[model samples]
Structures are given as structure tokens and as C-alpha cells.
Target: MIVFMGTPEFSVPILKMLIEEKYNVGLVVTQPDRLVGRKKILTPSLVKQVALENNIEVFQPENLRRNYQYIIDLKPSLIITASYGQILPKELLEKIPAVNIHGSLLPKYRGGAPIQYALFNGDDKTGITLMEMVYKMDAGDMIEKSEIEIDSNDDYGSLSEKLSIVGSNLLKKRLPDILSNNYTKTPQNEEEVTFAFTLKYSDEALDFNQTSKWNHQRIKGLSPNIGAHLIIDNVVVKVFKSQLSDIIDIKPHEIKIENKRLFIGCSDKAIEILELQQAGKKRLSTKDYLNGQNLFINGGMTNE
Candidate 1:
């Protein structure tokens, strides 16, 4: 019997794949339901929803370290985790042969926010790593790795979806071999390791003092969710899509409107804002937003 532990939408694909392939998934362990969104409504995790739909037994422990005896009782032949929010207890790791499906190439971006960090760092490529689950965070010996290119237009939302698909496919192909002890495990070189720490709301703020390229990367890295933010006219505006502009000469954080298009200045160049949302307002394209307002070139926007 296999036990799968995961949370969030990223883990749903793998759980679905395992069910479709008829794996003996004995239980699905995930984080507990919590209040979400502006409404503060309780919401179940995607993994939990998938588990219930398939009629698989589910467990949600507030503290896995203290309450994992139930998992042990399940007699899981193998344990697998994909984006599981909590670290397994050391005792459990020592007792069970567990594997994790990580969102990046091993030894690089090895932490909870690998996908966001990859886009934040402007990596040209990112992939999935199937690795042995050690007590340390994502420092396991890798069993398999698969690569996927980060397209120029790919944002965090799109790239995450792509990585999810890639991870599930790779897991489907390698899991049987891994279960039978026929797969090879490779120790990661510690020297090349880099960390991708979890992001906070503060990390979403944009700095116009940086080059336009940097700002563009920051925008795309966090777009469609946890958008890159800036203050305009005392209102927090979340920028979702932007492109580097050839126009320059304006001071950093200066806002310019031309032909119904919105642009903001950075250190090196300007970025044309394609999509944005003002605080408490719906997201809109620059054209749609401009249609409701008129601006003069000399009227500047404040970062404060």
C-alpha cells in the first residue's frame, strides 16, 4: 500500500495520475482546511478534494510530527509527497522509505518556494526532481530529474501548471521502478545548492530603482497570483502583466500615459503595463483602465 501526502493544486495532478494508473494508494494525507480569500470562507485543499472524489481515505493532522502514528498504522509500503506543506517527523523519515516530487532541479532552488524562486531569479529552465525524502528540507538524494524550458512569456501561474504536468508524467514513469528497488539514486553536490525560501506579502512589492529587466522579471514571477505591487495615488496597485519598453529618460517610479497606454519608469527603461488591479477593484487591461480616466504627461505617480 502507498500513502500520498500533498497539498495545493500542484499536487492534484500526481494524485489523479496515481489513481488512474491503479496504484494501491491506501491514504491521502494533506494539510487541514483553512479560511481563504477575502470572504474568509473555509476551503479544502485541492489534494483533499481529489482524494474524496476518488473515495480514498484522507487524513489531516495539525502537527504531523506528533500525530503521525495513524499514518504508520496505515502500513504504507511507500510514502510519497508532492508539495506537502509540512516536513515529516525525523522518526517517520528514519522508519519509512519516502520520496518527494520537488518542483525544481535538485541542489538548486531546494526549498518550499522553488517554482516562484525560479521565476523570480529569471531562470531559463526549471524542472522536477524525484528524490529520497531525508529529514532536512529537500536535501534528499535524487532518483530522477526532468527538464522543462521557461518560456519568455511564462509567468508563475503558467509555469507552475506546466511543471505540475511534467512532474506527474515523470512520477508515473519512474514510480514502479522506484517501488521495486530498480532505480538509481544520485547524491546531490552540496556546493551547488541554492535555497528558495517561502515568500511573504512584503516580497510582492516592486522596486523601480532596479532595471526594467529586473522589474519585468519580478512582475512575471509573481503574476496572476500574489502580483507584483506598487503604490499609485495612495492606492496599492497589483501589476499582473508588463513588457519592457524602449522609452527611457524618466525617473524611476515615474508614471507615463501615452495613447491610452500605461507605462512606468525604472532605472534603465520603462515597462508598459498590460494588466493591473487597483486596491479593492477588479483587474483590467491598461486600455480598459485608461478608458475610464484621463491623465496628463506631467502628472506623476507616487511609489509611496
Candidate 2:
């Protein structure tokens, strides 16, 4: 029997493929969902929804290591863990040789938030790795891997979708091979391991003093998640869309409000704020935002 464990929208494809292939899946373990959005309605995880559609037994234990004794009692042959939130222990590894589906190629970005961190730090190429689970986090021996090229501008939200599908396709092809034979495992070099920690709200703060290239990279990297913020009159204004304007020889951090448009100068480039969202307000473009809030233009602020 096989055991598949994961959570989030990223992990849904692998679960679906496993069921489609008629693999003997003993159980599906996923994390509980929390409420999101303006109305604060309860939301179900993608994994849970897919599991229900296929009629698979799902266990949404708050802590699989603490609350779920049934998994141990079931004693499955192997565990295929992809984007499972918590870390699996040595005890769990002993029962079955668990293989992890990591988003980045092993010995590189070996942690959570790999897709986002890859873009933030400027990596042109990123890939997935199937590896043997070990005590340490993502330091396991690799079994299979697939690589992909990243566009000049790619964010977590967009890149995540591509990686999720790539990982699913790899699992669909490689699972049967892994189950049939004992493949050689190569250990990852600890020196090459780069930790891509989860993004914090604090990391989204933007600096207009940075170089044009860096400013552009950061804005594009964080576009759909943890958006860049600028301090306007000591207020943190979230930047939704920006473009590098014509080369301007202006002082750094000098915000220009012209024709109800917000412009900030960098070392070698000018950033035109097309869309912005202020505290206690909805996101809007330069034209729409200025209509309702005339004070912004009067106060030398062109964005909401």
C-alpha cells in the first residue's frame, strides 16, 4: 500500500494522479484550512477538495505526529510526501522510506518558499527534486529531478502554478519506477544548500535609493505576493503596478506628484506608480484613485 500526504493548492495534482493511476493509497493527510478574504468565510484546502471528489480517506489532523495514531496503525508500505506543512520525524521515516517532492533542485534552495525566494534573489533557472526523506530538512538523498527556466519576470503566484504541474507530471512518471526497483540515492552537499525561508511582511518594504535593476527585480519578484511598499508621509503605501519611466537625473526618494501620478526616482531610473493602495482603502490606478481622494494631489501625493 502507498501513502500520499500534502496540503495547499500546490499538492493537489499529485494526489489526483495517484488516484487516477489506481495506486493503493492507504490515506491522504492534509492541513486544516483557515478563513480568508473580506467576508472571512471558511475555506477548504485544494487537497481536501480533491480527496473528497475521489472518495479518498483524508485525515486533517492538527498534528499528524501528535494526533494521528491511525497512520501508524495502518502501516503503509511507502509515503510520498509533497508540500506537507510539518516536518516528518525519524520514527515516521523508519516505518516507510518517505520521498519528498521539493520545488527547487536539491543542494540549492532546500526549504519552504523556494519559488518566491528564487525570484527575489535572482535565479534564472529552478526545478523540482524527488529525494529520500532524512532527519534533517531537505538534506536527503535525491532519486529524481526536473528543471525549468524562469522568465526575467516571475512571481511566487505564477511560478508556483508551473512548478506544481511539473512536480505532478514527474511523480506520475517516476512513482512506478521507484516502486518497482531500488534506485541509487545521491546525498546532497551541505555546502551548496541555500535556505529559502518564508517571506515576511517586513521583507516587502521597498527602498527608492536602490539601483534601477534591483528596484525592477524586487518589484517584479514580489508583484502578486508580499507586494512592495513605499513610505509616503510616514504612511506605508502598497505598490501594485509600477514601470520604469524615462531616465531622470533626480535625487533618490524624491517623490514627484505630477498630473495626479506618483513618480519616484532611483539611482538610474524613474519608477512610475500606476496602481497603489493606501491603508483603509481599495486598490486603484492613478486616474481612478485621484477622483475620490482630491486631498492626495493637494498634499503632493498622487496615489491612494
Candidate 3:
């Protein structure tokens, strides 16, 4: 039997594909539900919600490293993981064959946040990698891979959705060889490896001193979730969307408001803030926000 391990919306389609293909998925393992939003409502991960809907057994272990004996006892023939959030224990991996549907091409962007990094770097393309899972983080023998181009406007949310669907399809196409133990494993080249570690709190802060394209990429990489923010007047203003602008006269970190539009200066040029949210305020379009408030009259923001 196959035990599917994943969390988040990115993993939902992969889990559903296994079910649709009639694979013997014995249990679904996901991250625990946690409090979310200002009201602190407890919420299940998207993968867990899908598993429940499909009548599959679900498991949420707080610390999989210490409490993985239950999974071993099941003796699942294989463990398939995708964005499961936790590294599998060596003891568990030694006992069962496991594979992962990683979001990027193997030996590159090998970590917890590949999808975000792809956008952050302004990559022209990124793809899915289906590979064997070992003790190391994403350093496994590749089984199959599929490439997808990254559109100029694709943000974290849109790119993530594309990768997830591609991942599900890739896994479906290779399951026959995987289950039958008929696949060839190609080792990854150590020289080509790069890591895309998880984003930290500091990573969310935008630096306008960087080039306009650089700051624009940062906004795209974090959008629809952990937004890129600027500290203006000692208040945090989150920027969810932006576009490159022609204004070049404004000094770096300076703000320019003209014709109902908001622009922030960067090293090379300026980036027009398309969507933004002030502290304790709902997100609004630049046009809408300008219609009501005169908060950004004449001041330069600091990197700090």
C-alpha cells in the first residue's frame, strides 16, 4: 500500500491523482491544523481537507522525527511525499521505499521553498522532479522530470498552482514504473546543486535600494500570501502587487504620488505599487487607496 504524505494546496492535486488512478493509498499524512488570521480560527491544511472528503484515513504528527513508529508499523510498500513540511526520519526511510514529487528540477532549488525562489530570482522556467527520497533534503536519485516555463507575470500563487498540477500529472505518468519497481534512478550532479531555503521574517521586507526589477521580483515572489512590505512612517505597508514604472527622477527609497498612482523609487527606476495594505487596513488598489488617504505626501522610507 502507498502512504501519501503532503500538506498545503500544492499537494492536494497530487494526493487526488493517486486516488483517481486507483492506487492503494492506505493513509494520508499531513501537517497539523493551526490557528490562522486575526480571529485565530483553527484550520486544516488543504491536503487534509481533500483526504477527509475522499474517505481516507488521516494522520497529523507534531514531530514526525520522534513519533514515526506508527507509520513503520503499517508497513506501507511506499511513502510518497510532496511539500510535507518535515524531513522524514532516517529510521523510517531505511524501513520503507519512499519518493517525493518535488516542485523544481532536481539538484536545483532543493529545499522547503523552491516555488517562491523561482519567482524571486526571476527565473524564466522551472519544473517538477519525481525522485527517490533519502535521508538528505531533496538529494535523491531522479526518476522522472517535466519542465514548465515560468510566465513573466506568474507570482507565487499562480506558479505554485501550475507546478502542483504538473507534479500530479508527472506522478501519475510514472506510477506504473514506480510500483512495479521497474524504473531507473539517475544520480544528481553535486556540482549543479543549489538550495532554496524557507523564507524568514526578514526576507519579507522589501529594499527599494535594489533595482526596480529586483524589487518587482520580490513582490511577485511573496504575493497572495506573505506580502513584501515597506516600513514607512514607522508603519508596515504590505505590497501585494507591483509593476515597473518609467519614473526615474525620484531618489531611492523615496515615494512619488502622481495622477492617482503610487510609485516607489529603486536603484534603476521606480515600481508602481498596484496593490497594497496599510497596518490594520484591508488591502486596496493604489487608485482606491489614493482616493481616500494622503498618508504618503512627501517622505523617503528607510531600509530598516
Per-residue alpha-carbon lDDT of candidate 3 for residues 182-227, written as tens digits (9 for 90 to 100): 9898999999999999888888889988999999999999999879
In the range 13-103, model 1's lDDT, one tens digit per residue, is 9999999999999899999999976678999999999999999999999999999988887678899999999989998887778999999
How does model 3 score by TM-score? 0.97
Tens digits of per-residue lDDT for model 2, 159-264 = 8778888998988878877887657778888888888776677667777667655666666667764577766655667776677788586666666777777677
TM-score per candidate: 0.93, 0.86, 0.97
Candidate 1: stretches off by over 4 Å: 293-304
RMSD of each: 2.1, 3.2, 1.2
Compared with the true structure, model 1 gives a TM-score of 0.93
lDDT of each: 0.88, 0.77, 0.92
Question: Among these predicted structures, which one has the highest TM-score?
Answer: 3
